[model samples]
Target: MLQKAFKRYIDSFRGFSKEIWILALITFINRTGTMVLPFLSKYMKEDLHFDYDHIGTVMVFFGLGSMFGSWIGGKLSDKMGFYKIMIFSLLTSGMLLIFVQFVTSFIGMCFAMFGIMLIADMFRPAMYVSLGAYAKPENRTRAFSLVRLAVNLGFAAGPALGGLIIMGIGYKGLFWVDGASCIISILIFATLVKEKKLSTHENHEDTEKAVVKSVFQDGPFWIFLFGSYLTALIFLQLFSTLPLYHSEWYHITEFQTGLLMSLNGLLIFFLEMPMVTFLERKQVNRLKLILWGTFLLSLSFFVLLFDNWAGILIVSIIFMTFGEMFNFPFTNSFAMSRAPKGHEGRYMALFTMSFSLAHITSAKLGLGIVSRHGYTTNWLVMGILGLLSCASILYLKRIVAQSK
Candidate 1:
């Protein structure tokens, strides 16, 4: 019985190629260096002395850059090839981070954050395109989950180490470390990855037609993107609002907060792959997973309503991580499956844009609610949003089924 279980566990990783692993490695390295964004609110509040509104505005600027970056990355990946985009995003974003260390004024910091994220987030669409290009159809969900595993593993390390590093070298150290990781990943990718050939079979008329057909034209996908946007808005609260609430309400230190945040990644690292593998073996419906995931995610936020106890926070984090495991990997696979041939990058980009939209909106909206009502209000709002997203996703499933 144990041997059979072990065999099934190994089978989850069956279809990934050397390229997929290398890409996953690059993802791990990049995410491991993900020391800056998660802690940006703390740095702004403590170091720069920015208030909640100021931080929200800055985050919105960052979101603007990210949203534009994702859209452009998607469009450009189709035209320029994903390999070139990946190499450029990594190198340029790394170099840009060094400049982030020196910004002094509010406007200057906002612009710098915008530029950094614009370059940094261009990798999303390119990475998605690369994963789709590399993995087989039957194995695509597991492939995405594997890459997310690499990400979660890196995230597991990044914050815990970041907490220690911040204690020693201050916020500038975060920028330096983040920049170095991007550069290191560049070297690994450039050394190992051969440039992928773009589709060359199209005639002039077909090529012209392809250029005109955009990912936005798909109505059901638009609904899906909206639902994804709502879910992302709630999930991103972990980064945007939760840390601030911990510090202000619980008087938690930055290091402790980092440790708490790490719990989300750690839980996903251990459980996501195994859970996905088991669900696959059981042949679970993909749409059902997403719906349930959204519902659970909302419940995670609602868990925080019992905020009198520290233990409740831990429970909420665990629930949220389980929700993420259900939502993200399967959603990515579903998006890839929905892509019209030859436009995968654009489809992936629009989907990625959903998160970017969340980034832009969540911080500002969350901080506004916290400023006006209270932290509890923010959690309640997020829970409501999640419930709405569940409905949207259910509708999306119906649309997807009809199209099929």
Candidate 2:
């Protein structure tokens, strides 16, 4: 029985195409070097001695670059193709990582980080477009999950190793490793992944003849985007504020913090795909799953108020990871579902832009809250926002159903 169960688990991967698997592999490789961003806040505070306000401001710049990158990357992917955009992004961004090591001044670092993120984030929308190109409609959600699984697997390795690397070689090791990882992924993609072809039908016989609908005109998508944005605002705290919180409140070392961060990725890596597979088999409502996920994600922050930092953190991260599992891939799948064949890049760009916007708001707003009102108030506000996000998802469901 155990043997059969394990075989079934292994067989689950057979659903997606080989191209999708390659995409997953590329993501895994790139994310394995994802040591830099997760620890950027800590580096800023400790190594550079930046205040909360300056750190938040730097993050806002990161978000601005991300927002611009996604918008332009999506547009470029639609026009130029995913392979070109992704290859360019990976190569250029990798070079920028090494440059980031030298910037010591606050203004210089902020500008450097922005440039790095701008080039780096272009990969996201292009990756989303590639997933749509590769996966069949029925396999779309799982395809996204598979890519996310690769991401989590890489993340599982990155921070845990990064903590040790920081101790041994210092932060410069993070930059070099991250840069090398990006170059490695680029080589893999350039050699292994074939560009998806554009048929005459999708292009309307030529690029100029293709009719692209404005994302703003799609009412249900607008609602969906807003709901995604709200959830992102709450979820993004994990990157921006949570690390600092862990260091300060728990008095933990960088390795301990890496372990805490890795816990989220580890849980999602082992369980999310299987859990999502079960949910799909049960015919769970996608919108309902997103709603519950957002709620749980929000509640995870509030769990900090309960007093036992160690145990509560473990429990909270579990809930947060589950919430991430439900909302993230499905949300991307939904955006893909809504796009007309030729408009995949634009639709995905707009959808990704929501999270970019959230990165901006969450950092500036969350850090500001902590600086002024305290972490307790920040958690309370996030919990309330999460409930509001749930309501938005329900309303979004109604809008989608009405449109159908």
Candidate 3:
């Protein structure tokens, strides 16, 4: 059964060359190493004894850096080509990581944080921008699903690997691992990643000014951009604040805490493809599926405040995981579908920017709500936000219909 399943997945993406697979694997490597930070925060606070404000400050720097990087990357990808942009960003980030380990002071760490995040996130917009050239629209969502699955598989391994590295060697060791992985990816990319450039293939103007106009010319582009930001901000609080809620309210151990996150990633890895297949077969509207996903995700956080043990956490995860299967891939597919001809990089860059911007804004908003009003109110506010996001999608869908 497993053999047949693997063969079928191989057959599905006949458009993608071996180079694309390597690109995907490189993505998995980068994401896996980067995913260590969420778990690293716990070590920083609990073991190293940093205060909450310091943690928040570090997050702020990371977010701001990523926001700036995404914009810069988008513009660069439109002119310089995807592989070039991605390689430079990754190598720069890796070099920064080597420096991050030496910082023991607060001010020093903040500066390092900004540099690391800026470079790490710069690669993302270029990465997404590249995808438009490689895969067909009908299979685009599936392509994203497979990519997410790859990242999740890497994500699932990363925390445990980080944990063991922390246990055996030290916290600094994690950064070393991340830096080494980035170096390896940079080398692989230089050799194997030659999927034709989005700009030259699409004949986008090679000038910087031209690339800037391409990203923001249309009004609806901005609308979807803001929508993607909201979607990311409202949903991603699960990683940052959820653990705090579980720890303070339920007093769960650090091990169990990491385990719950692993559960989220694990669920995505095993179930995403099957869920996407089911939705496709049902002829479900992608927009509706995403909206439903938003509701379920919001509901998960709201319901969790009432649970006493891990059981409730597990149940809540089921909702969020269900939401993820539809919410993540469809939104990405929508971004690709909506791009104007010959401007794939611009649209994909916008999509990446929106999502990256949300991470920055949500760090402030999600943390502020939970820190101020308590977990119950935090969950409630996020639910309201999620519903508002759904309304935006519904409005967009309606507008599209009226135009037709």
Candidate 4:
């Protein structure tokens, strides 16, 4: 039975195209080297001697850059194609990462963070659009999960290694490594993957039947984005505020915190593909799964309310990891499905923008609450937000069903 289960797990990874595999590899390399983010808040506070409010403000600029990058990347992908944008984003952002470490003042750091992220995050929507070009329709959701697996796997390694780098040569080492990795990942991609026209893979049936409505006109899609925004707002706390909580509340060391963060990635690495495969085969409603995920996310934060035991941190992370595994892949697939053929980049840009917006809000709001009220109050606020997100998705499901 164990052998059979293992085979099944392996089988879920089969059948992807060569391009998809290459994309996944690039994602892995890029994310693995991109370890600066998981510890950025801590770096600001401890290394730069910034207060919580300053860190939050810097992060807001980071998110603003991400938002602008997503919008531009998606627009350019439709016009110039995903390949050029991907390469440009990686190369420019890699160079930026190396220089960002030199910026010490609060204002300088904020601009540095924003500029780096603006270049770096431009890769996101373009990458998503590339999957549509590369993966077969039948295998698309699994393809998203495959890339996500690479991301999580990279994340699993990145943070643990980052912790060591910090302990040894300090945070400066992280920036150097991060910059090199981005350049390396892009080199691999550029050498192996030739550019293809975005129109090459367009589904004629999809285009012919597609209404081509403006993203703003799509009511259900807007509802879905709002739900996603809220879910992301809560989930992003894992990276932003949670690391500080680990130190201040639990007295967990930086390495210990990295390991804890790594657990989220490890769980997604092992379980996300198989779970996504199983659900796809079962033909489950994506929105329903998303609602369930929102519930888990909310519960994860509520679990943190029981702050006495360190073991509770493990349990809370488990819930949050499961929430991520369920929420993210389906959300990607659903957003892709909603896009009309020619406007895929626009739709994807909007989808990614929701998360960027959430990233903007998550740090400032979460850190603000922590500075003023405390962690317990912040967690409670996040839990309530999660519930609201769940309700939004539930309503979205009904709207979709009635429209169908």
Candidate 5:
């Protein structure tokens, strides 16, 4: 059955020709470096002995830079071309990682992560837009799903070994590995991938411009983005809050926390593509699955609140992972299908902003939830909001139709 589903996913990509495979390989390599993320904080905190507030400060700059970079990256891809933008971003991301290896102070570290994230996020939308442009309509969803699965495959192994690298090789070793991965990814993309972006500047020859006139000006796009960002706000807490709750509240080991994240990635690695292919073929409504997926994702937080139990937390995370499988890939595919005819770059750029904004607030929002209402209430509120995102997606659909 697993092999059968895998074949369906590949078959779905029948008309993609060769461009899509090259992009997938590039994505897989770039993401492999990122998989080291699950433990970077723990290393900084326990080994370097940084305080919680300091870590938050570091994340703030990272978030701010990412938002700015992602917006610019999307437009640049639309104007200049995906391949060019990716080459620049990939090369920069690796250099930034090497820079981060040398930074020690809070401000310096913040700048490093921020710089890398800004560059990394810029290439993200172009990649998404390129996939849609490179593949056939029927294959688009599967292509996104396939790409997601490839990302998780790297993520699954990267973190598990990251823990060992932190122990045996030290934190600097992990950074070096990540830097090398980025270099490799950039080289592969520069050599293998080839996708041109649309020209943004009509009068300026071929210079890139914003995908559309003030992309944020679109009412539906912003609304959908906000709704999605809200989910990311809650979802991101898993990294920070989950460990604290598990270690202090649930008494789960530090090692176990890392293991749990690997488990999440593992589930995503094996199941994501198959689930996407099957779900795409089913008669079920797309919006409904998105809502339910968000709902399940929020439920992962709920288990932490229940007597701070590890078992429940594990199960809840599984639920959230399942939900992620349902929402994220399909959301990209659906957004692409609904994008305005001549504004693919603008469409993907604005869409990517939702998650960027969320990453900015995700940690602080999660911490705020715990401080004000306690973990349980915050998780419950987030879960309810996840279901509501369904309503928002549906509402956006109506808005799009009205515009049409």
Candidate 6:
């Protein structure tokens, strides 16, 4: 029985192209080094002596940079191609990250954060478009799952290691490691992945059927993007406010908090690929799955209302992780499918922009509520937002059905 299970796990990884594997490798390398984000809020609050409002403002800058970076990345990918964009984004962002540790003042940190993220996040849309270029239509969703596996695997490692790094050398060490990782990951990509024009043949039929000339004209997609924004807004709390909660409320140490956060990535690493493969084989309705995932996300926050037991944190993360596994890969696949061949970068940019916008709102709104009301109030608001996200997606499902 164990042998059969292992074989199934192995089989789930089969049939991907060489480029897909290389992409996954670079993602893993990059993400494993990305120890800064999970710890950024804590660092600002504890090290720099910033208040919640200041931290929120800095994060707003971060998100703004991400939003603009995603937009330009998509446009430039369409013009200059994903390869050059990927190199420039990684290389420039790495240097900026290393420099960020020096900026101790609130205003300096804000501008530095913005600059780092603006260059950094350009990789997102370009990477999504690259998947469309590289992966086969039949296995595209699974391919997305594979890259997510790399990301989660990196997440699993990054925080745990980051915790130790903080314990040993302080937060300054995180900047060096994060910066080096970006450079290394890009160098690896530059070495292995050769530049190529997007193949028009694979998506020609879908492109032909596309009636909307501009991404703005795609009404249902806008609805979907809004739903995505809500989901992202709710999920991003894990990085921003939740870490503070772990320290303040639960009295968890940074190392312990890192371990708890690592659980999220570990769960996705072990379960997501096989589960996604099974779902693909079953050919389930993507929107239905997304709705269920959003509902789960709502429950994850609501579970925190039972704050009597520290164990509830574990249960809450489990719920969030499963919800993430269900929502994100399918979201990528659906968004990619909506793009006409030539305009892939634009469609993907808008899709990625939803998350960037959410990142902006998530920090400010969550921190504001925590400052004014409390953590419990914040969780309740997020739970309500998750429900609204579900409704938006359901409405999108109906719109799509009517369009068909």
Top lDDT hit: 6
Q: What lDDT would each prediction earn against the true structure?
A: 0.83, 0.82, 0.72, 0.88, 0.72, 0.89
Q: What would the C-alpha RMSD of candidate 4 be, to one decimal place? A: 2.9
Cα RMSD for candidates in order: 4.4, 4.2, 4.5, 2.9, 5.1, 2.7
The stretch of ten residues in a row with the least summed lDDT in candidate 1 is 203-212
Candidate 1: list runs displaced more than 4 Å: 1-7, 41-54, 197-212, 244-260, 306-310
Off by over 4 Å in 3: 1-16, 39-51, 199-214, 278-283, 305-310
Range of the 10 consecutive residues with the lowest summed lDDT in candidate 5: 201-210
- Cα error, residue 306 of model 5, in Å, equals 4.6
Ranking of candidates on lDDT, top first: 6, 4, 1, 2, 3, 5
Worst 10 residues of 4 by lDDT: 201-210
- For model 5, the stretches where C-alpha displacement exceeds 4 angstroms are 1-16, 42-51, 196-214, 255-259, 283-285, 299-310, 400-404
Q: Which scores better on lDDT, 1 or 5?
A: 1
Q: State the lDDT of candidate 5 residue by residue for 157-255, as single tens digits.
A: 677677788779788888888878888987977777555543232222111122345555666666767667776767777766667777766787878
In model 1, the Cα lDDT at residue 227 comes to 85
Model 3, C-alpha of 336: deviation from truth (Å): 2.3
Score candidate 3 by TM-score against the native. 0.86
lDDT of 4 by residue, 1-404 (tens): 99998998998998998989999998999999989987898888999999978987898888898999998888888788888999999999999999888899999988898888888888999999999888887678899999988887888788879989999999999999999999999999999988875535544323212254676788788888999999999999987799999999999998898788778877887788889889987878788898899999999999999999999999999999999888999899889888876777888998999999997888779989999999999999999999999999998888777766
Clashing pairs in 5: 79-208, 81-197
C-alpha RMSD (angstroms) for model 6: 2.7
- lDDT score, residue 162, model 6? 93
**Which of the two, 2 or 5, has more TM-score?**
2
Worst 10 residues of 6 by lDDT: 201-210
lDDT of candidate 1 over 255-294, digit per residue (tens): 8877777787677766777788788668677879999999
- Model 2 score (lDDT): 0.82
Best by TM-score: 6
Whole-model lDDT, model 4: 0.88
Each prediction's TM-score versus the true structure: 0.88, 0.88, 0.86, 0.90, 0.84, 0.90
Per-residue lDDT value at 351 in model 6: 91
